[model samples]
Each structure stands twice: as C-alpha cells, then as structure tokens.
Target: SSSFFGDYPDVVAFILIVIVGIFVAMGSKASTNFNSMFTIVNMAVIVIVVGYGITFADFSLWTGTDAEGRSNFFPYGVNGMLAGAASCFFAYIGFDGLATAGEEAKS
Candidate 1:
C-alpha cells in the first residue's frame, strides 16, 4: 500500500482545497484551535529575534565572504535585502498545512 499512500498526500491536499473553498464561498472562514496561539508565538519570536539581532549581531559577518567567496550573509546588500524578501515569501506557506488534517483534531 506504500504506492497508494505515496500519492495520498496530494489527494488529501486536493480534498482540503475543495472543502475550504466551500466554507469560503458560504461567507464564513474556517477556524483552527491553535491558530491564535501559534500567531502570537510567531510574532513574539520575530520581535525578539529582530530586536536581539539589531542590538548585538555582528555587522561584519555579512561583509564576510562565504565558501564560494560570495557574500551570502543576510542583509549583505540591496540584493541581499531583496533576496531576504523573496525567501520570506515561504514563511506564510506554513498556513497551507492546517487544512490537510482529519476532523478528529478539533477535539
């Protein structure tokens, strides 16, 4: 059954897309129990990390070259800023997993 289960995740994601679409079309939003908790924690971590980074991180690190002799450290240049923004686009992709669950979770 491993072969069957191999494609199961995609099947499940497709099914969830359909269900969430229905809920959205009905003028309502689907809710999750841990969503608020997760959001608060996510924001708190970001604030703390950014604050700590600005306060104490080594500015010279980004100026240092990587194994490829390229400046790969974060916030390295204008290109780095844009690259960071592009990388961060995947952060919100975390939300896509919340829909691929069994109804037993709401308990």
Candidate 2:
C-alpha cells in the first residue's frame, strides 16, 4: 500500500532497516562518529534557518493590531497561550521517564 512517503512503503522500510542494520553492525566508535557528524549538520541547518528567519522577521507584528483590529500579540488571549504551553509541557513530560530509567540503570 502507498504511504505518506510515496508509493513503495515496503521498499522504503526495507531500505531504512538495512541502513539501520549496517549502522548496528558497525562498531560503537563508528556509530558515535557518524552520530556526531549528523548532529553537527543538524545544528548548522537550524542555525542557518533561524538566522534567515530573524533577518526578515517583523517584530512590530507582535505588538501591533491585526487587519481586523485585534491584538496581534496573543491573538487568542492569555488563556490560549496557557493552554498551548500546558499541551507542550504534557507532550514532553514523557522525557522525564528517561531520567527515572537512568536512575535505575546499573551504571
């Protein structure tokens, strides 16, 4: 069946599994080096994207009124912001379980 990645979901899955298996077969040092390289590339991309966004961002929009004369900042009001913050907090709350697991680890 076709998937979001395109038609050939099985082929994509097989390719990904093979790649992951290759990484697993490699020594830990090789895996760590590849992971570090990818992390650096990811951080560079993020920095570039953020820098480009900041260059064109209009800060006035944050405090100014919208075309409909509503407050631009907190367009949905403080309650909406609070609700969004709570949702995000709950979404990431699972990460705390990792800390608990770490505490229980032998090392």
What's the CA RMSD for each of the models? 9.7, 4.8
Looking at candidate 1, the ten consecutive residues that score lowest on lDDT are 26-35
Candidate 1 lDDT, 16-94, residue by residue in tens: 7887667545542243434455679999999999998898867778666787776747536788788888888788676
User: Global lDDT of each model?
Assistant: 0.67, 0.80
Q: TM-score of model 1 relative to the true fold?
A: 0.33
Superposed model 2: Cα runs more than 4 Å off: 1-13, 65-71, 86-107
Instruction: List the candidate 1 regions with Cα displacement exceeding 4 Å.
Output: 1-34, 64-68, 72-95, 102-107
lDDT of 2 by residue, 1-107 (tens): 66567644588779978876687577556656776888899999999999999999988888988888879876888888999999999999997996697456442
TM accuracy, model 2: 0.56
Collision pairs in model 1: none
